[model samples]
Each structure stands twice: as C-alpha cells, then as structure tokens.
Target: MKLEDIPRLSLGFLPTPIEKLERLSTDLGISLSVKRDDFTGFGGGGNKVRKLEYLMADAVAQGVKVLITTGGHQSNHARMTAAAARKFGMKPILVLRGNRPDMYQGNLLLDHLFGAEIDFLDPDAYFTEINPRMAHHAAEAEARGEKAYIIPLGGASALGAMGYVNAVKELAEQYAAAGTATPDYIVAPVGSGGTLAGLHVGCAMFMPKTEVIGIAVTGSAVPFSERIAVMANAAAELLDYDRRWTADEIRIENDYIGPGYSIPSEAGNAAIKLAGNKEGVLLDPVYTGKAFAGIMGCVKAGSIAKGSSVLFIHCGGSPALYPFAGLLTSDLKEDQAG
Candidate 1:
C-alpha cells in the first residue's frame, strides 16, 4: 500500500507551522528552524497526535469503543491517546507505570481531565508486564461486551509510525513552497523510537537530502539504531519501499539521556529555560528538553557544522512541564518566598 493508502483520521491540525528560530539561530551560529508538531491542535496537541491519527483510524474502523494503552505517568502519548479516545466517543484506559501520585500533575493531570480510566502499575513490573496489563484491560472490556483496541506504548507500531511518514511528504511540500532545499538535519527526541523510525523511512523516500537525527530520551538496554531500523524497515514494508535498513544506517545520539527516563537532567532543564526565554516556546523536561540539549551539544561540539540548515521537530510535551514547576523554578523561590 502507498503511504497515502493507509487509513487515517483527520484528527490533528496538519502541516503544523515551521518557524525559524531567529534568536537561537544567532546564538548557535546555525540556521535553525523548528517544525512545530506541538501545535497539531488536537488531543492536547503533540507529535503523538500524528501517530494517533492512524492508530485511532484503525480503532474506529474496527468498531472498537474502548482504547487501551500504556505509558509512563507523564507520558505525552497516554495523555493524547486519552483525549483522542474521548473526542471520538470511545472510552480510554491508560495503564501507566509508576504509582499514583498524591497530586496528579502534567500529563497525568490531563489524562484525568480527559476522563480516561487509569491503572497504575508498580515500577517493578511496569517494564516487564505493561503489555499484559493492557491485555487485561482489553479482556475486561470484552467481558463487559465492549470491543477494545490496544495501542502499544507511545503508539510505536508500524501503522502508527506511518503518520510521520506522511508528515515527511507534508514537510517536503512546505520546503518546496518556500523554494528551499531539504534541510541538512532533522532532529527529534527518541523515546519509543517510532517517530524516529518514520523519519528515517520518510527521509529515505521523500527527503533524501535531509539527515534524520534522534536524541535518546530513554536509556534502553537495546541499541536504539537496531530497534529503530527494524521499525523503519517495517514501516517501509507497508509502502513496499523495498529498502532494508541496517542498524548502522540509523543515526541516534544517546549522550543527552541524563540520569534515566522521566528524570529531568541539568542540561535538559537548562534547554527548557533557554527555549522558553529565547523563543517563548515550552519544551517538556522529559523529552524535547533533553533533545534540545543534544542539539546544543552537537552544535557547540562541532558535530553539526556552523551555518548548517537544521530543523528540529519539536514534538510537544509542554503539558508535562507543569509537574516540574517546583524543580524548574527553584531560583524564583529564593526571592519570591512569601
């Protein structure tokens, strides 16, 4: 099937705006622009909306009424999935890692606002048993005579990643309309790696001149390149693209993953503040913050050459920022302590 032949829901604001990072560009000595996937304008807005457009389309086609998925407590995916499910008149069940916090903040707070039925898994079993937990939810929904559909963590499935494949085509059109060549680098965060996989496949097909760069947000025991290649090849198979990718073909930098998943890093927090102060753009500490820090590191260290035309795919997670307000605003506390 062609990329366009895949089923999709028009759930997000497509062709999200690409804006030049004027201030940051000057600061970094590079021509930088950000593709604002954060402004997709649906289901709380994020890059997940792109994936959910395809994933939810399948659920709608199958007449599924209950959407089951799993993720971290601050998972932008889970929050957006919940919003998508509710908007489509389906019940959303989120099986999240980590115990329920006393105060729901960030994505967890938004998930609650979406009225999603939430289950908290013990951190011990969150990695080993999340799939089964989702399956259990499906079974329960089945027992209640409700049809259920399961979306993998971060909607990382091949069908879901096709959303980014389509996005590449949209991006190509935008650049062509502006009479610009393809960007030298396309940078984004890598959590589940689905978005990065789609980017790789899409770049190979639609924007060969552009290099896809993934900054790891999660510390995985498995190599990101290997996992991303497998997914990219699978997405390519959907379009009969015929190109099989080796792990080495995938470019992912893991230097930015400080501490661990969901834990804010010093560099990430600094990046978050920089982007906010420089661009008035909000980036979550968990994902985009770290990835932006990677971009800063790459540019400063001469990995990405000066004056390179770089595009950062700003996958949205601003909602996750609220949960870290205290950590992020400690400097303010010294002066404003009332």
Candidate 2:
C-alpha cells in the first residue's frame, strides 16, 4: 500500500510550519528549530489531529456512526478525537481515566464542548477496565442499531502512526525548500508511543542521517523503546514497507518524566516558561514541556554538541496548561528568582 493509496481524512492543516527558534538557539549555542503541529488548526490544534485524520478516515470508510476511545482526563487524543467525530457527524464516547473533576478545564472543557459522552473511571482501574468498557459500549450501541468504531489510547494504531510518518516526510520537504540542513536530532515526547514510533520510521526513510530522540513522559525508557519498535513495525507493515524497526533504533531519555504522568514537575514548568519567554512558544506542562526540558538537559550535559542542529517536534498540548496554573506560577517565581 503506497502512502498515497492509504485512507486519510483531510482534517488538519497540513505541512505545519517549521520555524527556527533564533532566540533559543542563541541562548543554547545550538541551531534549534521547532515543527509546530500545534497549529494543525482543528480541535484547538494538536498533534492528535494528524492521527485522527487517518483514524477517522478509516472509521468513516467502515461506515461508523459513533467513535469510542480511551485516555486520561485531559487527554489531547480523546479531546481531538471527539472534535473530529463531531466534524464527521459521528457521536464520540470517551472512556477517560480518573474520576470526574470538580471543575472542567483545558481539554476536559473542550471535550464537553464537543459533546463527547464521557465515562470516567478510577485511575487504578482505568488501564484494566477501559478496553472491556469500550467494548461493552460498542455492543450497547450495536444493540441500539448503531455502528461504532473503537480507537485505542492516543490513537496508537498502525494506521494512526501514518500521520507522523507523513509528518516526517513533510518536514523533509520543508527543510529542502528552505535550504536548511537536515536536523542532527529530532526530539519529541513519547506518551502512548505512536508519534515517536512514526517519527522513528519516517526519519529512517526520509531523513536517514538524523537521529530521533523520545522523551518518555509516562513510562520507563526500556519498555517505551520496545513499544515504539512494535508500533513502528506495525505501521510499516500496514504501509507495505519492508523496513523493520528495532528497539536499538529508539533512544529515549526517561530522566525528565519527573514525578509521573500529568503531574507537573519543576523542570518541566521552568522549561515551559523558558520557551514562552524566549521563543513565544507555549508548551504544556505534561508532554512538550518535559520533552523540551530533556532537550535542554542534553545541551547542558554536553550530550548534544553546541553546534549541532536540533529540531523539536512541538506536539501541542497548550490547553493542558490551564489545569497547571498554580504549579506553573509557583515554579515560574522560583525560576525567575534563581
């Protein structure tokens, strides 16, 4: 299956801009740039929009009338999926981990605004229960004479990863058009592994010289690396590509994850403020901020040479910032003081 032959819904603003961060580059003594997937221009603009383009296309192709997905309370994937479903005139059901919050803010608020039917579950039970619960919901919908499509967490399916694979090809074209060198490193956050896996495959095929790094925001590096390989290979097989990715191809730095998923860290908060103040780019505390912190840490540790070119894939989670206002403000105060 050639890429052009694959099913895809024209949902996001394609060929998202790749802009050089002059200020950040000057500060870090490196050539730094960012790929703004955040400007995808749908459902509050996010990287998830890319995956949904393919996932929703498949859903529509199968004559699905409803879409079901699972994720955390503030899941960008869930929020974007709901918005895409609404755009395609399909009902969306989100099986979110965590109890209903006292207040709906950020992506949670947008999920409600998009009219997604949300079913909240205990955080502990979420991992174990969400799959069965989604199946049950689909069964119920079937009984009601409705067709349903269930999307996995973060839309991390073989088809979904095609989004980022396409993104990498787009970035390569952008670089060639702009007469810029291929980045020495391409950095992104690893949540459910699809994006990173896609990047790994895409970079290998399009920008073979560039190294792809993943900042693990949710799990340990070892397991996430394995997961990425699995996802990358699966996506490759779906595309009828003969290449197979290995765990050795995945380089993930787990140090920046801090406390845990969705929990703000001092380093991540500081990185968020730094990007905002220096480059006028907003990064959410959960994913991009931590990944950027890892990038900064690599520069400070001499792991990334001063003159090497680095490109950060800003996956877009700005809405998530609203929920971390208190934590971010406090960290900003300390970051400013020292």
Candidate 3:
C-alpha cells in the first residue's frame, strides 16, 4: 500500500529538524548532522511517536476501544502508546516485560502519569516466555468484549515501519532545500529492526546514495541483519514497491552493544555525556546512546571518512535515563575542561 493508503494520525511535530552538529562534527573531523526525531512532541518526545501515528490511526479506524502493546521495562514505545491513546480518547493497557518494580521510574512513571494500566509478568516467565502471556492478555481482552490491538515491541510492524520511510523522504527534502549532498551515512540504533528496514528501503527509494548504518543496541549483527532483510521485504510488499532489498543493503555495527539490551556501555555513557555537554543533545542509555557510541567509533576508526557528512537519527529514549541516572552521569567528562 502507498503511504496515502495508510491511516495516519498527527502525533509528532512533523518534518523533524535536520540540523548541523558543528561542535560534534568538528571535534570528530567530519560533517555530522542529526535527524532530531527525539523532539517528536509527546511524552519526552521519541521515535515511537512517529510509529504510533500510523498505529493509532489504524486502531481508531478499526474502532478500537483499548490499545495493548508489549515492550521492555523502561519502554519508550509503551509510554508513547499510552500518550497517543490518551490523545485519541482510547484506553491504553501496556503489558511490559519483567516484574513491576517497587519504584516506578522512566517510562513506567510516565505510564502512571498518563493513566495507563500496566501489568508485569514474572521475571523468569516474562523474559523467557512473554509471547504466550501477551497473546493471552489479548485473548482475555477480546473475551471481555473490549477491542484490543497488540503492538509488538518497539512498534516494529509494517504499518509502523512506514514512519521511517516517511522520515527518509523528509530528510531528503530537507537536504534538497539546503543544497547539501545526501548524508553519506544514516545511523540509528536497532532493537526490533523495523526502523532500519524502513530506512533501508526508504533510502533506496528516495536517497539511493546514502548508506544506512544500524547500530545493534540489542541483538547480534547476524540475526539483526537477517531480520532487517525480512522486514524490508515485508515493508516493500506493503507499499507495493517494485524494488527489493538485499542483505548487503543493510549495514549493522555491533561494537557498541557491549553487554545486552538495556545494559549500558562505558563508551555509550561517554558518548551521551559528550553530546550533552558539547551539543546540548540528550540520548538515553538504551538506544540513541549506543548509536552515538557507534558513530564515534566509526569516526575514530576512519570508517566515516573525514569531512563526509553523516546523519545520526536520534530515535529518542531520554526518559529511560531516569532509572539509570547514576550510571549515565557517573564518570562523565568534565565539561569545564573543554
């Protein structure tokens, strides 16, 4: 289906800014820009807002009375979905992974503030076996005569992935207006792979010259690449596009993942500090921080050629940093030294 065919709701401050990162770029010896999808205009502003526009539109069009989604403990997707549901006057019920901790922080706090009903699963069962629980929750909701739609992690569905396709198109338009060459590389953190897949196809369709780099914030490069290919094909078919994406079309960097999903890396924390101190940019421990770390690694390794323009898609998870505030703020470089 074409973009026009998808039901969409306005959730973000559209055409998010593509601004030059002169300080960071100069320090790294490259021309770097940022696609500030972080400022997506709701609940601390995140990439999820873009995906939810289409997802919520579909929900509303289907006469959905309640929305359900699954995500990690401090899930940006869950928070954004709750906010969007509130926006449309629909109830949001989030089935988050892991146990509900005593102290609600980050997205969980936002969930409560937004009046979303949240249920947590037993740790062992949740981590190792969440799919069945999520399915069961949907079934229960259906049995209760309430309309419920289950959104996957990170809102990574074909309809949701269309957000990034539209994003690339927006970025290309911004470049054309500014008379700059399309970005040499477009980098983002990958969790469920939809964003990268969408970008893979979007760049191919619109900005063919740009390379899309996915920093694996969770999984390994192998499965991440495979999943991206799978999703890209699905997205292409959804849009009825003639072109198909190959594995080579997607590039993934695994160096920044370091430990595991939601775990912080030293490099990632440092990168977060650098961006905050130098450019006033905020990236959380989960996604954008890891991605920024990868971007820095690319610079240090000369993978991002000197003077070549690179665009880092700030896919937003700033609120999640609340839970890891101590971790993120620790050992930060002294801003005064610079």
Better of 1 and 2 by TM-score: 1
**Clashes by residue pair, model 1:** none
Q: CA lDDT of each candidate?
A: 0.92, 0.90, 0.85
Model 3 C-alpha lDDT per residue in residues 1-338, reported as the tens digit of each score: 77767778887998889878999988999888899998888766888887888888889888887788877788888898988888888788888877879899988999999999888876557656667766777788789897878888888888888989888888888889989789888999998888888898789889999988999988743588777888888888999998876776678888889788888888888888899999998888889888999999988898878888899999888888899977765545555455
- The alpha-carbon deviation from the true structure for residue 285 of candidate 1, after best TM-score superposition, in angstroms, is 0.5
Ranking by TM-score, best first? 1, 2, 3
C-alpha displacement of 271 in model 3, angstroms?
Answer: 0.5
| Most accurate candidate by TM-score | 1
In candidate 3, stretches whose alpha carbon ends up further than 4 angstroms from where it belongs are 220-222, 332-338
How far residue 67's Cα lies from its native spot in candidate 1, in Å, is: 0.6
In terms of lDDT, model 1 sits at 0.92
Candidate 1 lDDT over residue span 1-338, tens digit each? 99878988999898899999999999999999999999998977899999999998999999999999988989999999999899889999999989989999888888999999999999887888888788889998999999999998889978988989988999999999999988999999999989999998888889999999999998776899998899999999998999888999889899999998999999999999999999998899999999999999999899899999999999999988898999999879877876
Off by over 4 Å in 2: 220-222, 331-338
RMSD in Å for model 2:
2.0
Worst 10 residues of 2 by lDDT: 219-228
Two-way lDDT contest, 2 vs 3, winner: 2
| Local error of candidate 2 at residue 150 (angstroms) | 0.9
